[model samples]
Target: MARDPYRLIGRIQQVAHSLRKKSDHLLIDSAGVTTAQAGILSVIAGDPGCSQRDIARRLRLGESAVVAAIGRLRGAGLVERRVSDQDPRAVALFLTARGRETIGRAQETYGVLNGLVLDALGVGGRARFAELLDALDSAVASFPDRPDEAGPPGPD
Candidate 1:
């Protein structure tokens, strides 16, 4: 069968959008947080003193995007920022009592979505999908360094 990259890309986009909408409904309703906020909070829950840079790296998000998310989360009273005693210039993130409770409310979304993936893909397929995703990540990471192939499309 001929491979169509666009099909794969579109499928990924659709699945991501669907998952976001479903999770957003439950999370925003219960915790007053979106999936993005829950994700940032999860990182903080796992690593209490992590910096925004750490969250950005872990989430594969740009630093500026993480900063904005953090700002919103801070404003919502869901997260706290403290000047790191170890590094005066760096700010560390920690979840507040409210943040912890909020994440607790949203944790079910992760488990439910993960279970859906497992059921849809099966264990073997899940492993293969992980390998495929890692390969794609490597390809994308080096793509900018590679020379363009045939340049941009021209009039047919």
Candidate 2:
């Protein structure tokens, strides 16, 4: 039997989208925070003094998108920005008390969602699935940034 790789990839994307949509609903309803904001808060919580650029790179998001999310999070009193001690020109991000609480809730929501996914994969498949995902991520990370530059020769 022949395998259709595109169909498999589409299924993966659909599952990811569904998971994000459901988790976003739960997060917004319970913690009053969007998934994007929760994600930024998580990154800040993990790296207390991380810069917006670092967040953008880690999240694979555009600088402008990160900036807008940070603005909304700051306006909502969930995050705070301060001048970096080492780099005066750069800004460091930190979570507020409210942000901490929200992140805790977000973690719980993620835990539940992860459990569902893991269950679907079963105990034996879970580890292998995780390894496959990590491998795929690593491979994708090595690709050229611009689609136009993605031709056979190599990145310009």
Candidate 3:
């Protein structure tokens, strides 16, 4: 009998959860940065001068949550905000020197975890996993935008 797709998906998600937990623990142990902080830093590193709104959208997080996270990062001297050149009313975000160094360390920690995960998959399995992950991502991206798309789903 064929396996249920939903069951398989649930198993995959459980595996992901386990891996993420381990990764978060490793980050805290090695870099002293929380997973959430590291993720925000990575996003800022990729898109310097991004608006808080854009950051929230990309991370699928609440605008207020993003703001709070940014505030924390700013307080830590890891991020800076300035008025957007294109929109005077909008604030743009970027990493400070300290933030850049922290992000670099975070990336190294992530790289190690990634390498371990990939190695555990072996060559063929890794390639297939990447292909499937990409296909799923593309499929989700192609879906039509919903009314609540501007913000993340409401809290359950």
Candidate 4:
């Protein structure tokens, strides 16, 4: 996008930062929802009786993070928590009518933002981009913490 990445200038981290900033700002302005809230809402919309622990595992967030976000969503009247029928100690999450409406708005906004990427990448390019991204994700997942990663390139 800005010449090949070298260290910090053209790296994907910069692109991700810019994209997140703009998208987050736009969602906050137009949808009355943050990205995190929208994601949580979507999860609940998909699974009407999911627990907060389920959300934490699915979103790969800490339990505390899910708890805090759910607190805010509850305060906003977007989500309601009820005692689980299967486990009295656990709470199940459900989206309120307002949460569903906000999630719909957020989806519309995301499609609008994704439209820009589609136009830039074209249809075929987007497919290749997704494939490449998945490869990168798989490769980087469970990366070792030591500096031994500085080895020669492997077969790609």
What are the lDDT scores of the predictions, listed in order?
A: 0.89, 0.90, 0.88, 0.88
* Candidate 1 clashing pairs, residues 3+ apart or interchain: none
Q: RMSD in Å for candidate 2, one decimal? A: 4.0
Q: RMSD in Å for candidate 3, one decimal?
A: 6.3
- Cα lDDT tens digits for candidate 4, 61-127: 8889999999999999999999988989988999999989898999999899989988999988999
Residue range 1-156, candidate 1, lDDT tens digits: 886876987888888899889989877888789888899999999999899999999998899999999999999998999998789998999999999998988897677778988899997899999899899889888778656788888999
What are the TM-scores, per candidate, against the unseen true structure?
A: 0.82, 0.87, 0.80, 0.84
- The lDDT of model 4 is 0.88
Which number leads on lDDT?
2
| lDDT per residue (tens digit) for residues 1-156 in model 3 | 887887976888898889878988988887667788898998999999998888888888899999998999999999999999998998889999999998998999999988998899998899898899999889878888775656777789
> Among these predicted structures, which one has the highest TM-score?
2
lDDT of 2 by residue, 1-156 (tens): 886886987888998898889988988987888788888899999999899999999998899999999999999999999999899998999999998998999898888878888999999999999999999899888987777755578567
Model 3 TM-score (2 dp) = 0.80
Between 1 and 4, whose TM-score is larger? 4
| True lDDT of residue 8, candidate 1 | 88
lDDT of 2 at 119: 92
The whole-model C-alpha lDDT of candidate 2 against the native structure comes to 0.90
- The list of candidate 2 runs beyond 4 A from truth reads 1-3, 146-156
